[model samples]
Target chain A: MKLYSYWRSSCSWRVRIALNLKGLPYEYVPVHLVKDGGQQNSDAYRAINPMRTVPTLEVTEGGRVHRLAQSMAILEYLEERHPSPALLPAEPFLRARCRMLSEMVNSGIQPLQNLAVLQRIKAELKGDDKAWCAYWIDRGLAAFQEVALETGGTYCLGDTVSFADVFLVPQLYGARRFGVDLQPYPLLTRIEAACANLPAFQAAHADRQPDAVPA
Target chain B: MKLYSYWRSSCSWRVRIALNLKGLPYEYVPVHLVKDGGQQNSDAYRAINPMRTVPTLEVTEGGRVHRLAQSMAILEYLEERHPSPALLPAEPFLRARCRMLSEMVNSGIQPLQNLAVLQRIKAELKGDDKAWCAYWIDRGLAAFQEVALETGGTYCLGDTVSFADVFLVPQLYGARRFGVDLQPYPLLTRIEAACANLPAFQAAHADRQPDAVPA
Candidate 1:
């Protein structure tokens, strides 16, 4: 397996954590998002992922290589293909709650705060991009805190580190990067701290990635 | 099962289609997103869905009523509980492709063009929200067109209608609603036309809903 990833990408970070959690070894192919006008936009990379997004996982099965995109989908694929140390809850309702938390971040928060959207904020809207990112992040995290408080024990959906936790840690990194205050989200902060101590989360931290640049 | 929905919400439309495709009987409880500063923000609805989003599915299992928010999560739970007439492909790779397409719309396009985000764009950026919505819709649909072409036949995936089709139809409805030109996306339009012919898609369309207002 090989992953085309950008070190600082939140979506890329989510896939990395899932791979580490599942103990799946994959070669990392860095597709730098910042350097050279974003390598992901190149024709070669676009051939690999039509969306021109980072973290396309190339999985080889039955002598066929399948390249998959979208972080949540990739995570689900990982969970399905590698079931041990399951990233989703076995029960139906609990699974729904976990996925709901993941989608809250995936659909609600991340897209609004992504780099492409930020660039659009500046180029198209003539707006302050950081403020835009921070606004959505702050709103999303506050809402997430409520859900976390309701369902959480040690992670986002009880003691087990489900896909919700896998998804949250990266978004929290993104939140801090956008200068959103984490102080208001106590449950989220607590969960983030707990996840921070885990080796899988540690291994997938943006700053710890092979292609990470000095800040 | 009961679903809290808004007639024009694309996310709500997706859930409605999924329920129909799965042949599940669900009571439609309309939550008007545009009336009196949005009914979803009310304390009563917020008690049901903290995110205050449309298409919250309330399911009764083992005598416990579980209110599930997030359309994708709700769809997944429905698939899990009702395995026949599967919305996802049987193969893992095919499933990933279908899910990738779904997330591309869910996170990539839909969030950026949602009512709340458009309202923020208007209030915070003082930009034309319609244009902002159109820009993201055009970009995402263009990319989605490329993917659909790669993996499509009669539907977004193939002859069988999967969750990808379920997700795509509503987003296309949203794209047209936002005044996005669908001329460039022949595959998407073709698939949309195919999906439109299905009773499930027709049943779930915004205009056909109980709360639908005449154009």
Candidate 2:
């Protein structure tokens, strides 16, 4: 198995955490997203993943090169494929709650603040960088803060670190990186802190990655 | 079973389609998103769905009601809870493929152009309405077009309609509503045609709902 990833990508970090949690070993194949006009867009990489997104995992078994995209989907695949340590709850409604929280971050918060969307807001729409980003980041975070208050106990969903935590840790990492005042979101902050102590999350931190750049 | 839905909501449409596909009898409980500053924001509705999103299916089995949110999660629950007329394939990789395609629209396309996001972009951020809608819709459709071409034969995941088509139908409906051209995405259009032909999909059409607004 080989993962096509960029060390700093939140999506990649989500997958890394899942792999570590499941105790799966796979070769890390770094695809520098920003170097040389993004290796993701290259014809070579496009041939691998038509979507040209980071964290496309190739499973050699079943004689299939599965180009799995979407962080949440990939996490589900990993949890199902390697079911020793379940990342999601076994119950139905509990699973729904876990996925709901995960989607709140994955679908709700992440996409608007992504690199491509930010760039388009600047170059195509001619918006200011600092203000535009602050606008989107805060907008996404505000609603998330409200939702976080509901299911957030220790982790995003519950005391157990399910798929929601796997998704949340990365978004918080990105939110902090962008200078969003997370102090307003105490539940999210608390959730992040509890998640920070987990070894699975600690191992998947972007800074600890082999390809991470020194600050 | 009772579904809290707004006719025009893609999220609501997703569950509506799933209910039809699974042959589950459900009562439609409309929650108007636009009237009186959004009915979903009400305390009563919030009690129903903490996130306050549309398509909250209240499953009343043996006289107990359980509130479920998030279209994908709800769809998954329906698939698991009702084994007959399975929405997902038995095989893992194919299941992953169905999920990936579903997320491609759910996490990728749908969120960006959701009613709440668009309202924020236009009414809050003071964006040009036409440009704002065009930007997000076109970018998402373009990506979906590429993926649809690969994973599609007659339908999104081939002959049998999967959850991906359930997601894709609503998205294409929104794209067309925003006047985003579909000529560039023949595969998506083709898949949409197949979906439109299905009574499960046609019955779930926003216009066919009791609360539907006249076109």
Candidate 3:
């Protein structure tokens, strides 16, 4: 497997964490989102992922290659293909809850603040991109905190690391980068602290990636 | 089971289609998103789903009730609990493709044009909300069409009505609402026409819902 990723992309980070959690080794092929007019938009990259997004997992199975995009889709595929050391709860309802919380971050938060959207806000709308990102991040994290309060223990789903935690940790990293005040989301911060102690989460942190540069 | 939904919400409509497809009986409890300052914001509704989003599936099982939010999560749960009449492809790679296509609409298109985000664009950034919606819808749909060209057949994946089709139909409805020119996306429109012929798609149309008021 080869992962085409940008070091600081939260979506890419989510997949990195999942791969580590599943203990699946994959070659990291960086797609610089900000360098040279965003390499993700290059014709070559677009051929691999028509969406021109990062974290496209190129997998070879039975000598047939499949390149998959969309972080939630990639995560779900990982969970399905490599079920052991499960990232979701075994119970049906719990699994649903895990996915629900993950989507809270996935669809609800990340999309609004991604590079393309922010560029549109700046170039087309002439809006303050920072304020736009901060608004969505704060709103999303607050809601995530409210829901996590009911479902969380040491992790987002009661002492076990699940997809909820996978989604949350990267989003919190994004929240900080956007300068959104994380002070209001104690539950989420607590869960982040807990996840920070783990080797997988640590390994997946953006700064540790080969392509990461100094901020 | 009961579904908390608004007639025109694409996310809610996606879940409605999935429920209908699986032939699962669910009472439609409308949560008029635009009336009474959005009933989804009501304390009662927020208690059910702290994210305060529509398409919250309230289910009763073994004398316990579970309220699940996020349309994708609900669809996956329904698939897990009732595997027959599957909304996902059987093979893992195909399933991943189905989900990747679904997310092209779910997180990619829908989130950028939803009411809350549009309201923010209008109120906060003082931008033309309609233009914002059109821009995203066009960009997302173009990408969807590009990928669907490779993967789609009679449906999004070779005559099978998977989650990809469930997501695409509602989004095309939304695109037309936003005045997007659909001529460029012949492949997607073709698939939409195929999906429209299905009874499940007809039952899940926004105008067909009980809360729907004529445009």
Candidate 4:
């Protein structure tokens, strides 16, 4: 398996954490989202993922290669295929809650502040893109904190690390990048501190990636 | 089960389609997105879902009420609990593809054009929200069409009415509402036509909802 990723992409980072959690090793192929007008838009990468997004997983099984994109889809595939070290809870309702929390980050927070949308704000709308990103990030984190206060324990769901944690950790990283005031989200910060101690989350940090650039 | 939904909300419409597809009878409890300053922002509704989004599914099991939000999460829960008429493919790769297509709209399209984000664009940035939505809807639909062309046969994943189709139909409806020229996406329009003939899709149309306002 090869993961086509950008070092600082939250979506890419989520998949990286999942792969580590599942004990699945894959070759890391970096697709620079910024260099040369976003290499993800290149024809070569678009063939692998027509959406021109990062974290496209290429897997070879039974002499056939399958490429999958979208972090949630890839995470679900990983959970389905590698269920031993589960990334979701056992009970149905708990699993649904876990996914609901994950989507709060995946669909709710991340998409509005991503590179392409920010670029559009800058080019087309002539808006303060950083402020735009920060506004959405702050709003989303506050809502996430409200929900996590109910479901969280050692992690977003409970003592065990679930997909909610997988989605939350990277999004918190993004929140900080956008200068979102994390002070309001104490529960999320506490969960982040807990996840920071885990080896899987440690290995998936953006700075540790092969393509990471020094600040 | 009761669904807190708003007519013309694509996310709400997606879950409505899923519930209909699974033969699950759910009470449609409408939450108006644009009446007297948006009822989804009410204190009562926010208690049910902190995200303040529509399509919150309230389910009763063993005397415990589990209210889940996020359409993908709700769809996954329904599929897990009631697996008779499956919404996913049997093969992991195909299932992944189906989900990949769904997320193309779920995360890629819908979030960027939803009411809250559009309101932000209007109030904060003073931008032409309609043009912003049209741009994103066009781009996302193009990406969906490109990927769907590869995996589509009758539905998005080869004649099966999977989650991909469930997501696509509402998104196309949103695109038309935004005045996006659909001539470029012949394949997607064809799939829309196919899904339109189905009873589930018909039952879940925004115009057919209890709270739908006459045009």
Candidate 5:
């Protein structure tokens, strides 16, 4: 498998974590989000992902290649293909809880604070990008904390690590980038701390990725 | 089961369609998004859904009520409990295709054009909410059309009224509400028309809801 990834993309980061958890090795192909008017918008990359986004996984098996987009979908695909070390709980309600938490970040928070959104805010609306991002992050974090308090323990869905954790780790990184004060979210911060200890999570950190820029 | 729904919320509409498709009956509890300063944000409604969002499905089974927020999660919960008329295909790859199309709308389109997002754009940036919504909707629709061209037949994902259709119909409603010219995307409009003809989809239309006010 080959993953088209960017260093700081939360969506790409989520897919990387899932791949690590499933112990699936993949070639990381960097699609720089910043250089040359965004490489993702290039004709070649757009052909691969019409969404023109990061984290397009090209999976080759039995001499056929399946190019998948959308991080959550990719995570589910991985789980279906490799069921062991399951990223979701076996029970229905429990699995729903995990997906709810993941969507809270994926749809609720990430889209509102995506780089393209911020750039549009800055360019067209004359808005403070950081403040715009922080506001939504704060709202999403409050909701995440409420849900986490109910279902979380060492992870977003009790003792096991699930897709919720895959999403949470990167979102926390984004929240901080936008200067959201994490002090208000005890469960979220605690869960992030717990996830940080896992080797799978650690390996997928932004700084550890092949495309990471030198500080 | 009870669904906390508003007349025209895209997210709520998606859940309504899912419940209708599975032939599950539910009480409609109206949480008006525009009445009396948004009923969804009211303290009472917040207790049911901390996200303060519409279409929170309160499922009562075995004397316990499970209040599920996030439409996708609720759909999955319904699918798991009532598995006969499957919302997803049996093949993992086909299921992934369905999910990818669903997420393209769920995360890709809905969040970007949500009411709260438009309000934020208007208040903080003095931007035209309609234009802002239309722009994002256009971008998402273009991507949705590309994916649908590959997998769509009578419905998105090759004749199965899968989760892709569940998400696509409501999103098309939203797109039209924002004045998006759907003529550019033939496949999307065709799929929308096909899905609209289904009894399940018709029953879930925003205009058919109890809370809908006749213009």
Candidate 6:
């Protein structure tokens, strides 16, 4: 499998964590999100993912290729395609609960604070970028933190490192980048620490990636 | 089954479509989103759905209601709870594809054009509300239109009215509200037409519901 990834992309980071959790060997193809007017918009990368987003996984076997998009979709794809360490629960309601947590973060929290939206607020609206980031990030984190406390134990879902944790780790990474304080979210903080202890999440951290930028 | 709904909410419309698709009988309990400073945020509704979001499916039997938030999560919950006339496909790859298409609009397109975000843009950034709505809605619909061309035929993911169509109908309705031209995207328009012809989508439309604000 070949993953089109960026060091700083939370979506890309989520996929990386899932791959490591499943112990799947994959090659990473970096698409620099911020350099040279965004490499994702380039013709080469766009052909791979028409969505023009990082983390389009190409699953290959004897020259047969399958191009996939979206981080949550890709994570679920991996779970189905390779099912040893189950990312989702077996029971229906439990599975729904797990997916709810993931979507809450993936759709609810992440998109509002995405780089594109941030750039839009800064450039077009002449809004204070710092405050805009803080506002949305803070609101999103608060929403996730509330749910995390209810269903979370060591992980977002329970004791196991399920798919929700895969999503939460990256969301936290993005929030911290904009200086959204994590002090208020105790459950989220604990879950993050538990996730960090796992090798899967540890290896997938932005700073540890091959294309990670030096501070 | 009882659906806590509002006519104008895209999320509520999603559940309405899903229930119709499955041929399930459910009473609609109108929850006015805007009336009384939004009924969803009140302690009563919040006790039912802590997220304080529209489209909370209240299972009448046992009053053991599942407080599902996020439209996608609710749809998936319905799929699991009632499997016949399946909204999702049997194959994992196809399932992922359908989910990706649904989410492209759900997470990517819809959030930027949401009521709160639009209000924020107007009040905080002092942006031209008309231009703001036009920009995000057009861009989002165009992107979905481009991608929908690939896996689309009649319905979003083919002849069967999958979960993707359930999501698309409401989003297109929202898009049309802001005057997004659907002519340029032939596939999307065709799909929307196919969806509208179905009783499920038609019955779930904004104008058809009791809570629909008078024009």
Candidates' chain A TM-scores: 0.98, 0.93, 0.98, 0.98, 0.98, 0.96
Calculate model 1's interface RMSD in Å.
Answer: 0.6
Return whichever of 2 and 3 wins on DockQ.
3
> Which pairs of residues have clashing backbones in candidate 6?
none
DockQ of the candidate models in sequence: 0.91, 0.58, 0.89, 0.91, 0.84, 0.68
Candidate 4, residue B26: lDDT:
86
Shift in Å, residue A53, candidate 5: 0.5
The native-contact fractions of the candidates, in order shown, are: 0.91, 0.59, 0.87, 0.91, 0.81, 0.65
DockQ of candidate 1 relative to the true structure = 0.91
The CAPRI classification for model 4 reads as high
* Cα lDDT tens digits for candidate 1, B1-215: 99999999999999999889889999999999989899999999999988989989988878988899999999899899898899999989999999999999999999998989989899988999999889888999888888888789999888999988988888888888889999898889898998889898899989999999959
Worst 10 residues of 1 chain B by lDDT: B142-151
Of 4 and 6, which scores higher on DockQ?
A: 4
lDDT (tens digit, per residue) of candidate 5 on B31-56: 98878889988999989999999879
* Candidate 3 residue pairs in backbone clash: none
In model 6, how large is the Cα lDDT of residue B144?
A: 71
Q: How does each model score on lDDT?
A: 0.90, 0.81, 0.92, 0.92, 0.90, 0.82
Candidate 2 per-residue lDDT, tens place, A1-215, comes to 78888888989999999999888988888898878888988999988877778889888776857777877778888887899799888888778777877777777677777777777667765666556556666666666666657667787666778888888788877877777788787887788888889888898899888888947
Please tell me how candidate 6 rates in CAPRI terms: medium
Model 1 regions lying over 4 Å from their true place: none
Q: Of the pair 4 and 6, which is ahead by TM-score?
A: 4
Off by over 4 Å in 3: none
Show the colliding residue pairs in model 1. none
Residue B57 C-alpha lDDT in model 3: 95
Query: What range of 10 consecutive residues in model 1 chain A has the weakest lDDT sum?
Result: A141-150
The 10-residue segment of model 4 chain A with minimum total lDDT is A142-151
> Residue by residue across B1-215, what tens digits does model 4's lDDT show?
99999889999999999889888898999898998799989999889998999889999989999999999999999899999799999999999989999999999999999999999899988899989999999999999999888888888888889999999999998898888999999999898999999999999999999999957
Q: Model 5, A16: alpha-carbon shift in Å? A: 0.8
User: Which candidate model has the greater DockQ, 5 or 6?
Assistant: 5
